[model samples]
Target: RTSIPINSVDQAIGAIRTKIIFGGLVISVLAAVLGLFVSRRIARPIGQIRTWAESIARGQFQYRPSITASEEIEALSVSLSRMAEELRERIDTVIRQRNEIEAVLSSMVEGVVALDMEERLISMNQAACRMLGIRMSDMQGRSIQELVRSTMLHQFVNDTLSSRKPTEMDIPLSSDGEVIVNCHGTLLRDAGGRQIGAVVVFNDVTRLRRLENIRREFVANVSHELKTPITAIKGFVETLRDGAVKNPKDADRFLTIIDKHVARLEAIVEDLLRLSRIEQGAEQGEIERIDSRISEILRTAVQVCHVRADAKQIGIEISCPEETRAWVDPPLLEQAMVNLLDNAINYSEEGKKVRIRVTQEEGGMVISVHDQGCGIEKKHLSRLFERFYRVDKARSRQLGGTGLGLAIAKHIVQAHAGRLTVESIPGRGSIFSIHLPTNPPRNGSASHGDPLQPS
Candidate 1:
């Protein structure tokens, strides 16, 4: 109020105008600076956020946003980085799990096949490739009928596809080979019970089925063998009581027949017991390294059956190389050799020759017995080693054979970790070979000497 002077109108007007201009310019400059700072803070953060989202989409969540001095922006950047890292880790875990599952499915031993309702192969493992003899890629979208050559398997797969039920079947490969496949398939469904696809699992049971067949044969043979001896004993006893008991001479004749029957029973019992022992892990304590002198064992067997061989006029011949040897139990091998010789003498024609040969084979020794006998038919060979199985029931009974000799030999050979094989013709000569391991038992009563090498 003291500075406003009324003395000069021009000075007062100029002062008021200058002060008004200065105030407006100062306000304008301040507003411009404020707008620039606000736009930078908003636009810069949004750009960084957009780039981070793109990085996550592209599977690279490695980028971290720089924090600004603005508290809100810094907090937002920290949260965004945490979310991106979590997403990356989740995606990585999923990839790793998928790889592990794929590896397991590819390496499975069974033939794996998945299908849609259309009977086409959706997915299959590597083993399925080998089993079906087709490439995995080739089978992926192909119809089952086109891939499966076997009619039975083709039909089974079709049935499963139509019915959405599981099936199992046996498939034969050749005249001498077969496999049992237990297939289980289920209709895949979503939570709403809508049909999606099917998964099939295959389990192999070939060995188990073979063992069951062997067991059945054993039971049948045992029944037939026991029936013969029991029938004979009953007949002879009744005859003796009716006539032979009154006359001493007649009684003596009957007694001789009875003694043969008793011997047959004793032989059967002994063979059964021996088989039991062999099956119980071979009593590792009783194993021994025995003589491999094939000539000696064969000669001894011939001597034991000399009377029987002479009665039939069967000529026994030995052809063993001096260097041939085997690792065996002395008593067991001698008995096996004796059984073969006895069979030869009993079944051969008059004046026909029987041959015994010892030779070397891979990993073991081979002792063979050949006979010009009434040879076994092809069908009977499969059950020759079964207990009490016989090629000719009447002849075996007449000869007082218990029909367990071959079975006993087979068990003993298996107990020693060896193999037994036979080749025969219906009317020609038959050859029986016993393959003995050259190596002795690791834990047995007798110490292993240098095992005899086949020459």
Candidate 2:
């Protein structure tokens, strides 16, 4: 090895140390820059995910996190987005089901009410509010006894709640008079099979009860009427069979009496059949109506009653305009008019005039029979048109009155959309009138005339 100068050797060693120090500085700067870029790449996605999670916690499910830096980050973002969508869908489904249940309850016709186990009113339908005469605002959280004044209804709710089973009852509410309601109650339970509430439904049955009472009364009256005439006929027949018919005069008298009873029975049966047919026709909407002159109907009825009037020495004086007309079933109108004329002739004193008057007034025509007879009492006038009803039963029987003629006449007039009314004073006379519309309204139409006023 060749020996070099010592100063030159020292300068070479310093130059190598400077170069190593420069290289170290450059490497340190590069490493610091790489660390900052990697940290930013990781923290940017993490920051975005945190923001999305906070928004979701605040019920903003529409927010979605996005991460494109790494596959793991992207997977996390997709999963979070799917979770938000699923949660929103489930919430939406629950809300829709709740609305559907509310809608179904609102549209019900029968009164419906729901109460919690604490006896607080949870919900009520429109019909329930109407039936109870209360508002929803007034009924909320109120106890059953507090809202409903009826003791029977309160007891029914209590019974349902205690039994945890369905119960039914008929309750009478007396506001104006008596209104009957059919109520049914059932326990409401949750998914855990735990009783949570009760639901009550109410249906109005007032008209049904009234109809039942009327039906019962009609049956009783009909039985009594039929028995009376049959008993009389049987007694007369028994008298004849017991040898009272041995003498010609006695036999003739008994035969005449029996014939009269038979005629009365025939009249009753005929009137009953006619009344039934009229009611059936009215109910089935099968009445055939036509425009007929009122004068002609009155004249025809007068002719039919001519022989009876002659026997009673009662003159039927008709006063009707020739041009007056009514919308009616012609045969039915004639029958009703004849019944009125016969009643007038039978009730009037001999030598008295039975005036048959027809007048057109106020969108309708009125045909009346005025008789000078023992007029009806005020109490009897209300029920004069009822079947088998009579003010003087003995006098009606003696005059061969079946007690159904007025009832038949009333029904016939009603079927024609007309009214049969009576005006009377006990000592003076009675006026029986039939009011018929000139242009009767069609069935189910609302623009109809007012009902007849009581006289």
TM-score of each: 0.72, 0.70
> What stretches of model 1 exceed 4 Å from their correct place?
1-84, 103-110, 127-134, 149-177, 191-195, 236-259, 281-285, 290-295, 321-326, 374-383, 425-428, 448-455
Counting clashing residue pairs in each candidate, in order, gives 1, 0
Error of 2 at 128 (Å): 2.5
Kindly provide the TM-score of model 2 when superposed on the true structure, using C-alpha atoms. Answer: 0.70
What's the CA RMSD of model 2 in angstroms?
Answer: 7.9
Per-residue lDDT of model 2, residues 363-453, tens digit only: 8888888999888889888779888888898888788788889999999999988899999988678999898888855874223222333
Model 2 misplaced stretches (Cα beyond 4 Å): 1-107, 117-119, 175-177, 247-250, 282-287, 306-319, 343-384, 389-399, 419-435, 440-455
Clash tally for model 1 = 1
